[model samples]
Target: MTEAPGQITAETPPRLVVLISGRGSNLGALIEACEQGQIPARIVGVVSNRPDAGGLGFAEQHGIPSQVLNHRDYPTREAFDADLATAIEGYAPDWVILAGFMRILTPGFVDRFTGRMLNIHPSLLPKYRGLDTHARALADGETEHGASVHFVTPELDGGPVIMQARVPIVSDDTADTLAARVQRAEHRLYPEVVRRVCSGEIQWSGRILQADGTPLGAPLQLDEDTHNASPPQPAG
Candidate 1:
């Protein structure tokens, strides 16, 4: 199988097509990162399933191409995904990023960009896989909870993790408070993972994740402390 478009050489920055459904603070972060030359990639376009998504406005303000294909207008999930894929492929992105894209894509749609797409979830994988993650974490009396960035797979939140950001669940933290902290961490974590992916330092080999050609066996962790530290040395 051919490598995903995410696999990039050192010479050119990766091209990105970011998808969003809401306000898209993460999308804003990406746009800032690209502008500041922090992440070695370019967001060529932003697509939203909601016509009124705020991110589209952010994209326009920054002069990035934006599009809306309301999922509600489509007859079925597969049809929506087909058109969505076509719209995204038009940009010829090296990666398709789901930055708070709330839709659950069809299997065929996911397969079309299997190894090239990515998503960031509000909770650690194998844990609060769906919504209300902050509430769930608080209710569970979890001492620590955070966000995860992973490859997009047909199984919801089941793809091999690329990186994670962990934060302490304080004694009196409510869902909103906890979510705020996690979002800050996410703004840091997601770009770093993208940097690694763009630098050819880490990659998905269809089934497993590898750093420098060696299997990771599990996703790399990026806690609050290490979030600012140098990137982890690849395991031998």
Candidate 2:
């Protein structure tokens, strides 16, 4: 495990195991923040479900160890998650972060970790909880779209949210355009959420999420855009 870039003079930093499956823009943000003394956590290792994921390169560039456990290699999702659990446990991570891991984990695996896991969903969550969130939101003519960082549970995106950043869906926005904006929010929100979790400022109870014991903002329900300063709306 490499030392996290930031110094934690006041508290102990959590060791992190990050999972990724794609371009890894959010992972890059976290690595940069940790390296720059911004986030208060050590990235113990990076794991991916795809060997070709670009996040592996990002981790390698920063001198962090990276591993891949391809889901296709396993006989079932449960088996793959089991291997993943074993690999992550070997590193003894304090936090398991799903940066962009595209797989849905089993309840057994999620239960094993308890409140130790975190994930960022592209939508505000409790809304468009599954895949293709941006496109789905656009197709639904939603005015606002954003990113959320929440505790991971067996029920997908059902855990309480820690933090979020909102981006209005402009009328001209395509799924690609909207996704770029949401991704930027995800990049910013994930690092900040990680910092808080590592610093003991936030708590994940597995059932409810909170910041410093008080639930942060409103609940992360999707239909209302609870975290937005100015929610996006359908074009008049």
Off by over 4 Å in 1: 1-11, 226-236
What are the Cα lDDT values of the candidates?
0.86, 0.79
> In candidate 1, what residue range of length 10 has the lowest lDDT sum?
1-10
Tens digits of per-residue lDDT for model 2 on 116-216?
78899998777899999999999999999888888887888888766667789998999999999888777777887788777766665554456556554
lDDT of model 2 at residue 177?
93
Top model number, TM-score? 1
Q: Over the full model, what C-alpha lDDT does candidate 1 score relative to the true structure?
A: 0.86
Model 2 clash count equals 2
- Candidate 1: RMSD to truth: 2.6
Q: Per-prediction count of colliding residue pairs?
A: 0, 2
Question: Residue by residue across 1-236, what tens digits does model 1's lDDT show?
Answer: 22355565556678989999999999999899889988878899999999989889889999999999999999999899999999998988888899999999999999998888989999988799989999999999999999999998999998888888888999999999999999999999888787777767777878768866777755678857656533444544
